[model samples]
Target: MKQFFLTLAGVFAGLVLFVIVTPIALIALAAAGSSAPATSPNTVLELDLREGLTDQPPTNPFAAFGGAELSVIEVVDALDRAGDDRNVKAVLIRLPEMGMTPAAADEVRQAVRRFRASGKPVIAHSQGFLPVGAVMSSYMVGASASELWMQNTSSFQATGFAADEVFLGDAFGRYGVTADFEQRYEYKNAVNTFTESDFTPAHREAMLSWMRSIYDSALANAAADRRQTPAAMRQAIESGPHSAEQAMALKLVDKIGQVEEAEAEAKRRAGRNAQLVSVADYVSNHGLQPGSGSDAIAIVNAEGAIVTGRDAGGGFGSGSTIYSDDTAAAIYEAIENRAVKAIVIRVSSPGGSPDASEQILAAVRAAKAAGKPVVVSMGTYAASGGYWISSEASAIVAQPSTLTGSIGVFGGKFVLTEALGRFGVDLRGLSVGGEYADAFSPTGRFEGQDRAAFAASIDRTYDQFIARVATGRRLPEARVREIARGRVWTGAQARELGLVDELGGLHEAIARAKALAEIPADRSVRLIRYPTQKSPFEALSEAFGVSAEGAQALVAVGGVLASPEAQGVIARARTEQLRARGASVLADQPVR
Candidate 1:
């Protein structure tokens, strides 16, 4: 027994040593081998959207290790800087195939337009715009460029966005699984997936309303960028998938050729011997220095599903989760920071725990009380609990295509009594408390007092939600209730309904924050990340500080860092990260 203990201790010590030493070695090598090239005259900054864009730098250090992914903010800042850079003669972008979230695409398109206004031509090249989903969003950004290039024989099938919801009510019934869910109102359709096979009238109405709004925004923006009338552009896009040649013929694309030819064209347009540099690399080495000014706008990112407690360290099956504790801490830090003039909380969630949402909202209120105006910047979508946290912000800004406002509550669980009984497994409960003690038991369904209690809890949550929205938006309680039946709304719709203050992206949100704080428009203000983003090494140290599992994860990370497959892992991890940020099963459809 003593020998076994000694061996186990020795193994743990060895693992700790390996985890610490291997990463340091890998970091040193990565630094030495990947030195960014010096920015020189006549350089063409290459922005590759082929991998898509993340809203922000990754929060997890382990995930951060595998890739050098640049966020939308990073790209926007880099392009803006490059526009004034004498060294950067032009810009080139490789469009994504899978497409980007409408909000992210809009932000990049705005940046591209700004870059073009500097008299430096921006060229966009696309292999194809496959019609998987949100492909038109990819085309929207491409259309904003000085030249749109497509690969030979590639299809341009960026038709429109469509989401398919999976209804498991029938399946559950057949399998003897009872989905016992209750919602505050009919339009809170998240529970409908388990309760009904088809869309209810309210669900259909809400879905079409937001979908059409987003589609119109995409079409109008694309048409304006392509220099065509909205009617003509709508007719062209609605007319099935067009070939690259057909797109060129219809003036939907500027040029058609292989990727190499497109590159040559970009080089030609850039004058002579213009070197192509990765925008990610350029930004890492020379992007706008954050926190460079005396006065700062602290950005607290509340991304993923709103939940209680601290981050779970992103273990297996752990998608993006915004812990209330972490989010509140970030907001409180900003409130206490003397240099912070205002706070901008970037939210991209579809809702989660109501209690968690309230916790975060309290922090936002605390910031306001401290004289630091709090502005909300909605990304992709921020519905239900997402909106709950945002309701009291000093100002709310969202992209036209962003989905927000699902002011409702729903809660319940799957009753597996019959299913388990059929399998000869009984999940019986032995309770010594009141009758409602078995209310949440998997083997029992809510009945009598338990049912009444559950219904009351749900109603309380709903009432609180509507009251908060009414108070925050300064609307009447009746007016809030009329619009609140848990229906999701597009940012454009929300703006019209007075749910959101403005329709814009993070850039505009920052501007709003500046105005509220009385900062001059012309003066540059330092942007500080709330919760204080740590260096990769610092995060790694914290990760390893936790447990043996963290050590094992670090070891796996070391293997990845040392291997050539690190790039591929980075791409996959980034996709997962984006999904966690944008995909929610609560209120809005998945963005991209």
Candidate 2:
């Protein structure tokens, strides 16, 4: 019997060995076989602006998975490198379905113009032309293109800007649901969508004015770049959508052709035979090697809600949360690295955990203590915990329409006892521990001292938040509270409130950081991005199998649960839950 068992065990071990070693051996053979020059060697980097340029949580999965999105710095750096690279002859700018913010569009336009000045031509292509947003059909930026091509069958759709608001008041009324929220700012219209059928006059007026400013700037830039008058571009925009031939006649596009034809034209202009390469591929090939140099500004981005602790699944699964530990560690590494001279905190979050916020804030402080200037650039929405980290920065820059500042906190328990009772299930417990032991359980209402204790803790955290902001912004505690109370504000309003120092975009933030660091404007400053690091082996493993790193995250979370830090973890989790629930109540404007 023992001999039979040993034979079975030996067979199982052999199977396991084959399972592990077969793939690696195959990969090695494949790698060896493909060790040749790239087939499409001479490349024309294509920057296809299909989605909205955002620093916020990506609304679309394509942007995250397809890797088609670019941050402001990423776009600029690509342009700079492409312009200088002899192998990269020209650029194909495809704005087939762009939905970028005005500021981001402007940055790209500026970069395009700079690239063109290098004597490298840029060819713009679109499937169907559209002027739906300032970024989509900015005449000012379009003007910079050496040639604009639209599909032969395509037509331009130039609908003027409109901010549509969706209200749920009637829906809630039918369900007997009520929304109770407290906010300090008159412009905090987040709750309006829940309470009103349409925008209030104030909201409409504010939104329109902001839109107009952005559109006008875009039009002016496009006109200047395209060598057309603003009046002419405005006339074309007002003429509505046009067929390909009509667009060419109206000087809206240079020609009518397919994407391949446009690429060919670009190649011809570059005076070289080149293959078109995606921007990501080009960056992968030519961008700075990670951790290679000392004079670099690492951009550490935390684009979504900052939850506490670790998140399994790389924070990519649907409804999965952002892990503050991962983000903070990224920042910490950048700060500790002598290779990174400065840090850019690009935030697009609607806030999350107070504990996580403090964790990040401490890291930012540590970065400063290391003599690294940390500059913050706000994206679409950076409120609450987002603002918490930014308040510690040496300088903060935001676009005029950027939503920021929700200086408040709330916490509550979710009671499911009645629902369970209805289902004929009951939970009874006897505990010898403290009252707070069951503070977070979903089955019971937090009553008596438990409720009071939670509230007191929240208040203490709030006080700390205010104090931190006061120190960061150089404002008194009382004055900060005046604008606190979970109020949200637009970038312009934030600037007026002294919450942000300037009204600008990412480039401006970088410039400010460079100036603070005493680097000359003309001198080159290399940017270094943090976290987003992976070895070729790791990448291959991810492409083929479940990542060991993911397993490690689960183990780490389990360890946290088993340790003394469990209380802090639980508190942070509760804070994140509140923030997630309160997000809709704290937006300065309605999400589209």
Candidate 3:
């Protein structure tokens, strides 16, 4: 019996070792075999926008396993390089069915325009366009190309923007649940989703403000590309969904055919024997690091909800979530690096924890004290806590459609006493010392002195937020207060209101950083990204403790659970979990 048990233990140990080593070996072999291919003469660069883009590169390599993943920076840099490459002739882009965010579309469209300026043709092909999301943004990008093509059967659904939200107040009331929340002012409507049945007056006004700004900007840009007046473009697009043939008649699209025909046209433009090379492949072959020099501009990415403590690292079936400690540490590291001349922090968040925002804001101040000028580049949305950390930057740059400036705070919790009673699940509470010790108890209501105390704390936080913005932007306290009232603004409106310094994207931010650091415009400076990405091998080693149980967990995580569909579900779940935890300074604006 003792021998049998020992043999079983040995077999289990071997199985664990095999399970661990096999994947590592296979991945290593795959990496070894996948050498970068050389670019041939007269190659046409093909870029597919169907794969969504993020602000920063994936934290782990395994993220590239299922499909090609590209960041906005990567796509822009690749096009910039390809424009100058003599071997590259033309570019082909495949548009998505749904659409992209307004900011992302603007950035890529600018790059496309720059590429077209080099006298090379850019052909954009769309399989179809849906009215589900920001379809107009996608059309704006396609219009930037030298020629736009749509599938024969595809419909052009570039209608105006509209926002729809589902409020849970009535449902919760029917179920005997209570949602108690407080805001510093009237404009902070995030809590309204839970406490009210529909959009409040302030909410409707704020939504319309940003949506109108985006609509106008998109029309103007697309009109410039198509050589038509903004009013004419708007009239044509707003005139209901157009069929492919109808779009051609209206001059909305230059050509109509299948995607394959579009590809053939691009290749024909590239001359005979021209190969269609993927943008990813081209980038991999010829590395396109922005610059290289002794002096460097550090890029710290703060994308996702800002919570306290170290980052969860977003490994295996997870998405990006910003952690305060990690972000602050990255800024500190940039400040400490002697070679670092300036810092450009890319921010893409709707805000998170108040404490975390304060911590990161302090780091930004410290970097300035160390003589490293900091420039903020706002992504899709940077409101509430996101704006908090960016308030003191040397300069702030944002896209015309970027949502920002929700300068307010809120705090409260739900009372589940009635809800639990309905389910016959009573939650009893016990107190130890202070009378208000159980005030935060989930089963009870927040009232009396305790509620007042909580409200006071929120008021103090809001005051601090306004003060920070006033000092950073060099505006009067009265002016800041007028804009504070928890209001949100688009980047264009924020610029006019003296909230944001410039209206542009990452490229503009980097240029401003160079000017502030006294670096010459003609000189090249290396870009060093902070909170550096980890290798898959390193991530795996840390994730799995090399034990049998860890190996088992790895297998379970990597199997059907790692599929693209499954990972998306897991990512949404993780986002909701993080959102709930970081609601203190949150100004969440759901993508339309």
Choose the strongest candidate by lDDT. Answer: 3
Root-mean-square deviation (CA) per prediction: 10.0, 13.4, 10.4
- Please list the residue runs of candidate 3 whose C-alpha ends up more than 4 Å from where it truly belongs after superposition: 1-36, 65-68, 284-290, 312-314, 546-592
Question: What is the C-alpha lDDT profile of model 2 across 125-218, one tens digit per residue?
Answer: 8777455554343444555788888889987775455556789766655554444333333445666666667777756765665567566656
**In candidate 1, how many Å is residue 55 off?**
1.8
| Candidate 1 steric clashes | 0
Q: How high a TM-score does candidate 3 get?
A: 0.87
Tens digits of per-residue lDDT for model 3, 1-592: 5544554465455434344444653474365457755568888999998988876665665655534477777788889888888888999999988868888888899889989999999999997778867788899999999999999988988878877888999998988778887797899988888899989999999888888998899889999999999988998999969899988888889999988998999999999999999887776565446588878999998888889999544245336677899999999999999999999999999999989999999999999999999999998889999999999999999999888999999878888888889999998899999877887788877889988887888889999999999989999988998988888998999999998999888888999999999999888899888877664445555444454446445554555553557656654554465455552324333211
Tens-digit lDDT track of model 1 for 1-592: 5544554465455444454556654563465347555687788889988766667655653443454376777788898788888889889899988668888888888889889999999889999888876777888999999999999889989778787789998998998999998897888999999988999899999998887887888899999999899999988888869999998988889999887887787788877887888887787666445746689999887778888999745221214568999999999988888999999999989899999999999998899999999999998789999999999999999988888998999999889989988899888878886888778988867888888999999999999999889888899999999998999998999999999998877789999999999999888899888666544444545544545456446655666655545545543554454455553223322211
Q: Model 1 misses residue 228 by how many Å?
A: 0.7
> CA shift at 178, candidate 2, in angstroms?
4.3
Worst 10 residues of 3 by lDDT: 583-592
Better of 1 and 2 by TM-score: 1
Better of 1 and 2 by lDDT: 1
Clashes of each: 0, 10, 0
1 versus 3: better lDDT goes to: 3
| lDDT at residue 532 of model 2 (Cα atoms) | 64
lDDT on C-alpha atoms for all candidate structures: 0.82, 0.67, 0.83
Q: Name the runs in model 1 displaced over 4 angstroms.
A: 1-21, 28-38, 65-68, 312-319, 546-592
